[model samples]
Target: MKTRFGKLVCVCAALCLLLSAMFAAGCGNDAHQKKIALVFSHEPQRWTDGAQMMKESLESDGMAVDLLIFHTDEEQAAMLTQAVDEKPDCIVLAGGDIKNFRDSLEKAKEQHIPIVDYDGLTQDTDAVSYYVTFDNYGVGEAMGKYIVQKMNLRTGGGPYSIEFFSGSDTDSNAKLMYQGAYDVLNPYLESGQLRVPSGQSDYAASAIKNWDGKNAEARMKELVANHYQSQPLDIVVAASDGIAYGVIDGLAGYGGTWPLITGQDADKKALGCIQSGKMAFSIQKDPAVLNQKCIRMIKAVVDGSQPEINDVTTYNNGVITVPTYLCLPRIIDKDNLSAVSK
Candidate 1:
């Protein structure tokens, strides 16, 4: 009888231990089941590369990531809708406005899911969770500073012609970048240190539709034909590398003295151009670095902590000021570009 009791006791203890192990696993499953959705505009290679980095990072943290890529505005809206229907814990938007995704993002509001904007902003609304991007104004300011020094705009002692081309006005970064460039160069323009003989210097007037290089090239050609036919153009400030390519192409066709040109986005072709002395500089906004910052923000959100927001007053999404983490951008010129190549 004692042997029988001992065996029963052992069986009971075994059952209890088994139940405890199962319960612990259940809790762990709940912890690991947290889900996030990554949405990308997918048009620009930069955006796609950044999104991929974010996805890999999130998955490494043991959370499931649903990466959605959309090409058109309508596709973006539909993808957001579908993502919300999945009831994800959070959504990361690479680029686009809340207006295009209003219906779906409203569902996000209803579902209590937060949306993080990466490298760009959507329309201001309660749905916006956090914002991360480079100091866009500073980016253009860097370009402006480089241009001023290269062209001797500050002390050139006379009117030097400069042609300006901005990214699409629809882009928030483009607007801020143009504003930064204007803040620096406008003073020179007003002080008569520089001139735009083509009179195509207005940011609004010089905006590149869709950020297309062809459009920019066409404008560059027009400017060269109408204004620089007989004289050397001192400088041309392009907001992005694609636009810079167009501007350079126009310069090449004009067959005149090459001007000191500046651009953002260290694109391979642009970097080649810089190496060949066709372009002066390109801003290095490393996609992998920006991706890591976004991932850190996501982990913070998931851990129920505030993300590492560095700026609170600068970026307003039209509804309210968004808490932002701005990354400083670096310049890639002939002097230090070898480091990048290595």
Candidate 2:
């Protein structure tokens, strides 16, 4: 009877040890999970897609992600402050205006939280560790190159009347894109092959506030009424699809052939317009490519490894040169629309 009782006591002790070990393993897994804070300034479809993809990808890697979207600069600043207070392992920011978050970013720096600046460029570099984006200059160059090829500008075929519509002046990417387009078009403009009837070639003159389609539409109407009444407007270098659509709306009842237009962001409506021959082409910055790069970078930072960087010299955020990964953008036209759609 005594031997049987001792055996039972030993068996119970073994069971308790096993249960404790299992509980410890569960807590270990929980401790290993990383947390991330993702913030976006706007809810455009592309950005929404990016947010979803990033969340899914990070969660799949055993990380917890909090997504925050804001509409105004003030709102974004507040959101960033809140995110910093949460003390996540990493923060991903996509904002049109970065200067507004200077104080919040400083707090993030104090807490040693890594920041990945996505899409939008910023002047704050001390806290921003990595930058992931499609090549803005390349996007502009593609647009300008498409216009040049279509207009036969290099082959001396264009004495075309062209109008320029640029993105918001506040966006750094907008300026880079405009520069890329202008660099390609300037030679022709100097040679009189491309004439700006309104003489608004400068970025400041052509910039649309906040990239608003309505504002672009209004400007397009004013330009058409003032300058294009006699001569045909042969080409339009619109920096984005919104601007392109505005140009299309402004020209609805002008009773002339549609001009060859260049735009960025392969918006669905813009693609339909391309198919119907209303607009020329647009540059598509694939969100999946950018999101994957961001995920890899975020994971690397969380794991205490150096993330992959392709370009380090191009992106200087006022304070320091940021390590950057640039994804190339592709041109989407009627001929290649089905390929991209698939």
Candidate 3:
């Protein structure tokens, strides 16, 4: 009887220990669970895909993620403020006018919530902890170089009529891209190899507000009607696929042959355009790669370790030089369309 009682007690103790272990495993401690807030200024397909990928990747790693998207600057500022109040471990920001977000960024800074500036948000503030984006200048340089080689600018080709379309005025990346292209093309313009028929060569004159397709479309139509009515436009330097689409739409009404157009962001529609021989070439900046880099940075911040960065002196946010990881963009044309289309 004594032996039986002792064995029963041992069994009960074993059961209690197993139950305790199971309970602890089932109910994960909240203290160790990291949280991240992802904020985007707009819901363009690219941004949408990036947000979804980031959310899934972080969540799969046992981290909580809050995905927030806003349409306008005001909406973004408010969303940022709200995210700061929630006190996530880190904030990943993409696409938005950074001027309106200064106060909210400051608040996040005060709260010790690191901000990962995905893509180029602003170069005028040091509120962000890290930045992950493609080399915008290089993207533009690729476009310019492509045009130069195709047009044989180096071999003293005849003067070609060209037009330019830049992104929104608020985006620093736009300026950087414009500068890169302009630096390459300006010499040609000065040497009479390329001429701007519309006289809209400067960024201030060529910028499309909000990078809106409609605005770009309207501008293109106006330029065609006013300037390209007589002279044929040989080339168009569009800063993005959205602007490129606008240029295409603006030219659709006219019966003129499509000019050699250059664009960024190898969007599916733009790739289709390339396949159809409507667009010349586009710069491919894969959002998946960029988002993965951002996830690594966020995880580093959560783990209290130093995140990996490549370029340090390139991105100057006025207050301090932001540490950045630059992903290189590639040109996608009809020859290689099949590779990226899949």
Candidate 4:
């Protein structure tokens, strides 16, 4: 009878241990289920390689990420309405489309939802709690400096004209990049070392591509058809490598391959183009690093800490530049392609 009692006690102890284990597992799963809502102004299907990397990196953090993709400001507003309704713990927006749903975001703010912005920046919206981005003007300056130095344009006897292809006008990054390049090349243009004849034509022949590669290509074809000059284009200052690829396609079969083309993004195809000497340089940005910085910012907010901004200023465009968190932008050419890859 004593042995039977001993066995019964052992069984009871084992049952208690099993129950405790189950409870611990449940607690862990619950802890891992924190929901984060990621709202994008652009469709996820058409997101750039950098944006796609960010999504993957966020998913690896053992939290649930609910991505609501939108293609237009109107679509973004509608999605923001829905996301606010869902009452997510955190909201991540791609850009300044914050204005589209300022009211809805205020509602989120009332509910204590933390907001993070990436890609493009937004202004003094109470809804935008944090901002993440690279140095837009600096990126362009880097590209411009590389081109000027590489091509030996300052000592040029032969004329070289770079066709500037900008991104979406609505995006602040596009404007800064274009202006930065202009600042770098303008001096040379005035000195008769670098030529931009298209400037005299009201820049009508040149086009703003809205960051679309196909659009850039179409515009390049139009320039080629116009036969703007007897000389071949010496440089194509593409806003992104994706657009650079399109420009290359448009300039195809023009009797001879054109001169140096500059692009940003350091995309795989862009790297390939560099290897083939079709592209002069690409700016390398690691989305993984950017994602890690964003995660840190979000976690800081969640931990009841405020993010540090380098400097905050309001641009004339009414867009507020909150603390600048600019990442390192590297210059990539054929020699450095392998170093910048995944």
Candidate 5:
């Protein structure tokens, strides 16, 4: 019995050695794969479809990702600092004003941890690794053209007007979208082709949604109450689907249906509203394509490969003009909302 027990112990030791070798090999493989850190402005669930797309696409590329979500600007900066400390192979930042972390981001850059600025953009900074996002100005232009066309269709030969609700002032994405729309719409407004009502008019009263539904609802309510007391509003141009929903809720009790509304993000609820004809249109941007491009940018940096970039608008961080990738935005109206929603 003693001899049998010794033999069993030897067998167990041999198996353990084999297992250790296999585990080491697996660990080495994992280490060989690049490590990526994703720092986002908000929680994943609260993330716009665009954010989700980046996360999914990066993970699909066999790169290990660490996500750090910050709820506030300060928190975002702190996370950026911490990520730099971790010395990740490459760090990806999406959303919010990244301006708060220029110093820390620079530190990471000095350490050779390239940063891929995803979605949101900051004024030319040196910490940016590569920029992967849409042509925000183009998005705004689309909105403007669409609004003009819709107004013409709706009013025929009559006078019509519109209003705007922008995202947070700090968000460059919001600014680009708003500016794009404004540029396109401004000409018509100047030509007297479109008359925005009064300060109380929904089309005239502008509020910052900050990309929060609650904030959007509150702002929309204010617009509704103010406009109802004065003249009726004809159009609402919201920066996002979440903001548009808020406007709809505010208009719910206005004693009349709302005027034509335009939104972006093509969220599920937005799709539903479009189907019912309550919402006029939404710009459809595929999150998958957005994310895939983001990953490509990140992988290029991680693997030390050159990324394809549109240099004209690339962010000139002190070290390099990181490549910027611009995805096109498609407008979705009731005509093809179903196909676009899918």
Candidate 6:
């Protein structure tokens, strides 16, 4: 009986060794080296900055990342198709047109490859596994509220002249943001507290094509030539800081008082403008928190673990509602500018 117990102990030790070897070969070393593909339809400053943050975070986690950006929709589709063929651990759609890559993304879904939408919210949420972005409406509401407070409309009886310049019509966030501003400023419009000297108050009507600064500049010029030439405008709600810069340039050509401008995304140029009193303030959406959450989700999905998602109903990407995580936006002004700029 003593000899039999010794043999049993030897067998248990051998089994433990085999399990340790298996873990080291499969989950331990292999899972640490994950390959990720980041594909973008366009390379905007805000987008590229976020991409850099994601790349650094992933690389720090021992991930191999492929960052790709395209100028045309067709280019985006072809590249996404090629990425699907490469079969990286996962593919990140780093801000792009969803309609452009829906088919290729579906192919990925069929192959069980995970897809992440990093700020490019499309109507086709079914093609994406997870969606993440700042609360766009909240960003707009913050700007509207700030403008209202700055104008002192609560106590002042005068009607302030204002113009609204929304971002591109193609961007889904643009609509939500404008709608948020409209929700707050509409009451003032009805009460005759806020007036549009340019008479272009509709969101759709004032949308900047491509969100191009040149186009925005042209529109501002037109607003001046048609309406503000005789007198300086009081306020202009520029949706993005990029658009605000253009508005500022156009106003520079004006012979009247510089108008108050509101913007989102605390880009360097816009921040400088705010410091110089050209712009009022901006809402900043920091990418650090979002990128960290993104890394967590990617790690879970790659390791065959389910990720945590909070919003299941707010975002419907045409085909199906995709699981999402929403990040709140923060208002940035002179009070907090040093924290970021300095």
Model 5 lDDT tens row, 183-289: 88776776776676544323224646457767877766765666555566777788888888877887766765468888887767788888888788988777777
- Score each candidate by Cα lDDT: 0.85, 0.88, 0.87, 0.72, 0.73, 0.81
Ranking by lDDT: 2, 3, 1, 6, 5, 4
Better of 4 and 6 by lDDT: 6
Any idea what lDDT model 4 has? 0.72
Each candidate structure's count of clashing pairs: 1, 0, 0, 1, 4, 2
RMSD of 5: 6.0
- The superposed Cα distance between candidate 2 and the true structure at residue 334, in angstroms, equals 1.7
Where in model 4 is the C-alpha error above 4 Å?
Answer: 1-34, 41-63, 71-75, 95-103, 109-112, 123-126, 156-158, 200-207, 314-319
> Highest TM-score among the candidates is held by which one?
2
Of the pair 1 and 4, which is ahead by lDDT? 1
Query: What is the Å distance of residue 228 in model 3 from its true position?
Result: 1.2
Instruction: Report lDDT (Cα) of residue 274, candidate 5.
Output: 89
Give per-residue CA lDDT, model 4, range 1-342, as digits (tens). 999999999999999999999999999888756677777755223244445555566678666667777777788898888888887768877753455788987898899898777757655465567677777788889877877887787677446666788766666677777777778887777777667656621233444645678888887777777654476677778878877888888886465446788888777777888888888888876676676677777666666787655546632235344565666678888766777654
lDDT of 6 by residue, 127-229 (tens): 6788777788788888888887878877764587889999887777788789888888888888898999888988788899877778899999888889887
Q: Residue-wise lDDT of candidate 2 within 1-342, one digit each (tens)? A: 899999999999999999999999999989768999999877457887898889998998789999998898888988999999989999999865767888888889999999999987777558889999989988888888888888888889879898899999987788989999999989999999999989899999999988888999999999889987777999999988988989899987576667998888888888998898988898898898999999999999999999999999988877898899999999999889998764
lDDT of 1 by residue, 45-114 (tens): 8889888877887888788999999988888888888899998888888777666888887779888888
Comparison by TM-score, 1 against 6, better one:
1
Model 2, runs deviating above 4 Å: 1-25
The residue ranges of model 1 lying beyond 4 angstroms of the native Cα positions read 1-32
lDDT of 3 by residue, 7-68 (tens): 99999999999999888876767655899998886646787789989899899998999999
TM-score of each: 0.89, 0.90, 0.90, 0.79, 0.80, 0.85
**Candidate 2, backbone clash total:** 0
Candidate 3 residues lying further than 4 Å off, grouped into runs, are 1-28
